[model samples]
Target: MRPAHGPGGAARAGDLPVLAVLYGRGAATPLGLTDTARGRCAVVFLGDLGDPLVAADLAPVSRTTRVVDTRGLTEAQLCALVVGLAPDGVVTFSDSLLRATAVAAKACGLPFHEPDTADVLVDKFRQRRALASAGVQSTACRLIRSAGDLAPALAATGLPAVIKPRAGCSSTDTCRVDSAEELAARYAEFTDGVTRPRAYVLEEYLVGDPSAVGDFWGDYVSVESVTRDGDTRTVGVTGKLPLAFPFRETGLFVPAELPADLVEQVVRLERRALRALGVREGVTHTEIKFTPGGPRVIEVNGRIGGGISDILKRSSGVDLLAHAVDAALGAFDPPEPVLGLDGSGRRVAFQYLVSPPSDACVPGGDELLDDLYDIPGVDLVDVGITPGWRADWRAGTEWILGTVYGSAPGFAELRITLKAVQDRMASFWSEVEV
Candidate 1:
């Protein structure tokens, strides 16, 4: 564990409210969170990152930063740490840490999602039951702890079902099962190891309504909300690009292009799901898909959506990370963020992703990031690789090689820019078996 403060991190932040973030692997970069939170309050990035945030990472941000080492800490132990921090609020941008963090927050009497709500938020199977019991939407689901549990899961979820870890993030290890044989085979493969047993949820597959979103857009949209003591205020609905093969996300855009009625339905369903899960206070990202029957919830994540901060900040002048911290502290709304590149002019911003097909060597590495600037409307590009890695289909968006974030004046322009970038990017890779 490293020291909690860097340089002058212990300096007083002018008596501002203290916000302790349970930081780890999740949405929002350490810098992004700090940038948004600069003067609003003092921030303590507390958690086990297994390494200190490099000085380069902390160099730019002003104000005090308390980066504590919290490895090997239990909930009660974490609660003790929180008490020592003496924070006004506790929050996490991580889905995996949501539950334990909630327990710690509650013990400290800090504002956060309570334990029960946090449990449902992180566990897909439990969430499904909660929603169904509350009459939100009932999609058949079964939890499987071992291979022998497959029969009941298959019976309940049926063929063409979706299988995923009960509590996972960014679609990792999530896949669709098409047939009884494939379902059994997948279950066997997933639990192959005499490695410790794992728990997964077999769910009724949600077929996206192509007619609802047409082409180019994903059938699903995530509703972003800021909830305070159970009263949720919706920020907006985000649109997404069509998923890559086997359910990996390809991209996402801001201000989803939904009909007025559809937006109403998505928001209404999100509110119900949140209520059912009992998410009282948090910045949440709930994914709802429009299906043949109607809009249905895919899952409700308690923290900010992965990559949501980038798209939101690019598309609108909103700092979602800042909002999360403020929600934790109470209704501490600052003036609206400066929108767009020009402050007032807004654009159709997007986080376009590129993923390699399974069994293939990943494409161009970090070198190509330089070439990305030539693309029209391109603001930032980050392709995380040096090119020797193999693309595993099950890795989901976490394994995406790179992402391009930028904005266009309108949907048409944004669409054109996206296509051009995708086409240009594909040329960087010569597909080959890994």
Candidate 2:
């Protein structure tokens, strides 16, 4: 990989800035980013060990790696660690650690989403209230603490409501329950087992534009923007593939092909949503839907869109990971991403590898990896689950067999590349054993 040049273009000798980061999955992505920004790494680990793939990268690049379970510590203790590390900036890309990172960034007086607002961004219930209170046009939502609350919540939101943990990402445990019985059962799974947020949120369902089906557009889109000192700048909007029902994201196509008017409308709605959340600094991923009535906000995340960073890099000539480092250091102010529509424009996408229903038998095995890697236009592949892991379809993103990243000269070509690979994988799935 080529060394990433900083916002200043280059770094002088003895100019290795240090950054303290909260370690999470894909730590290498961020660690490499800091290195490209001409900086050293220091990691704060929540678990006893970091993700193995990331740990390997962290070893050589990180100046100091501490295993501090911030979950057990108070805000002051976490703050002390940040002040003691005394790095130039602090950050974490993990949705699970955004609030902690924001708190530490605040204690260190670094540029990040303000700690108070960060909490609101992490909690969907709070996020909904904030958006609606600010007149941002959001769905009516109810917080559910137990099974007893399900009926009332359901009645309030009507049928086909969305249920999810108050705080989570990757669409984990998110589902659309159409009946009261299914709603109660789903709520029980969370309350009785997962040990997640004490309360889950039930929200009125927002449908997508009826005409979007033929365009292959998902029910919603996300605006990847950066906020600097209370000002927000749009990076690009992403067009999602049909979600894997209930709510699993299959893929994302960047520089979404939307009419000029709709693009402006989305940008304006995103700006209003972010302002309501008080997201004054750092990057944000805001998901919005084009409902029959108008655009409605789905949710806002105070970080970069996870795997879509590659798509952004390819389609817009912007390295969002590197841009994140620039944001942390208070030196980021790049113009909005420039997208092209001609065949000359770059088109990139990421397709998650997921299994069919568990009872379904499938074929192929370790050999499938080779086939995926051999596919043309496939640039990167990461399998979260190893062979013989007993794929469980109910595990949400946890069941992700892997992901394939690829790019092409235009959206049409990109779709061909992705479809070819996906179809090949499907063939293997049909013959493999469960």
Candidate 3:
């Protein structure tokens, strides 16, 4: 394979220069991607606001790579900033930024990944329809324009459905309704300018074990490889546990503990869905559910998933971001599956933060960390929440409180370890005062 190169063809693999743009702080996409890229990269942060915590995360890598802050620049101005860097390639974690970056890159005649892939990933309604056509069984969904259309949409798809914005990410603007009355009430919340019609998808709700949520609602389970021509190859499987509610991803464990036969089924379904979506290449984060009969797709994101990739790296020691960067630079080849960390000696768990109710104040940061660290086999604790950051009650779009990570000798031990972690967290929250 040819060495990975920058736009100017000056840098190569083991020495390739890369540029990553992040939309906001706590965005694992660019950070993970940059880590996978090793030290041969630079990062350009684009946003109106900045976070010191995020800057701290990027600080260690500042020695070898440039970190440009362009919070005040317009999109055009940002484009100029990016071009001036003369990066061999540019990558972004936000779909909106991806769209803007793609346009600017194309205008400058620089190589870039397909912009449609970002749309396919960010727009839930469009993603579902595309996957459905590919023979992937997905939730019936429609993009609703106004509250008036909610009734008709419900009539078409049935009740107990999910209402979400078309362009929404991270479960933002998502509502699960059980009745027409509930749907209307939710619609009213949107109508009052509390929620904008940025585009929304109302979907049929599938019932299943919450523990198996990712399997039930995810668009695909098999890890995929896409080419510049839009060809996809299913490589491996990932499993997700249920989020708390409304929107809080709990954790994702790699080498999904599913049976071998079931894993194959998920791979087949994912392949079909990727083809249907016209996804050629790059990383895809697809969620799938395993029904009594077989596996069905929930949704597909044309980019690598947030926590899963991180888990995969910890479990398998293979770097997905580097692979993606190589592919974008036209020097990547499909990789062989590296056997993840052996299950005999250890079990791994990746956790996301979920805040308690708003009326209830969570425990102080130090106390919370202290409790998590008390869990057996605890290895790392990444707390994203700060004093001023908003906290939620019940699971909602803003529920990532903090992550508790650890490993044990086996699954049972791992469960005990994680349970202890949870118990401590619960105790901490319960004891704290608002």
Candidate 2: residue pairs that collide:
362-431, 362-432, 362-433, 363-431, 363-432
Instruction: Output the number of the TM-score-best candidate.
Output: 1
**Among all windows of ten consecutive residues in candidate 1, which has the lowest summed lDDT?**
334-343
TM-score list, all predictions: 0.90, 0.85, 0.79
- Put down candidate 3 lDDT per residue, 352-396, tens digits, no spaces: 354453435555557567666666778888776566654553325
Give a tens-digit lDDT track for model 1, residues 91-131. Answer: 88878778778987887787899999898888888999999
Model 2 alpha-carbon miss at residue 181, Å: 0.4
> Candidate 2 on 1-434: residue-level lDDT in tens?
12322222242244445556676653225445544455333234432133465455455544433344344566677778677656677777777678778888888888998887989988999888888898887577999887778788888899888898888777777888889888888777766755554778999988778474345557678898887788777878887776665576677777776777888888899999888889899888889888888788888988887666777776667777777777787776665564445455455555544544333544466567667777677877765545555544345665566667776666677667777776877666653443
Deviation in angstroms for 304 in model 2? 1.0
Ranking by TM-score: 1, 2, 3
Residue 69 of model 1: what lDDT?
Answer: 65
Q: Number of clashing residue pairs in every model?
A: 0, 5, 27
| Global lDDT of model 3 | 0.59
Tell me the spans in candidate 3 whose CA falls farther than 4 Å from its real position.
1-15, 18-35, 39-86, 104-113, 194-196, 209-236, 338-349, 352-354, 357-361, 384-390, 393-397, 431-434
Question: lDDT of each prediction vs. the true structure?
Answer: 0.79, 0.70, 0.59
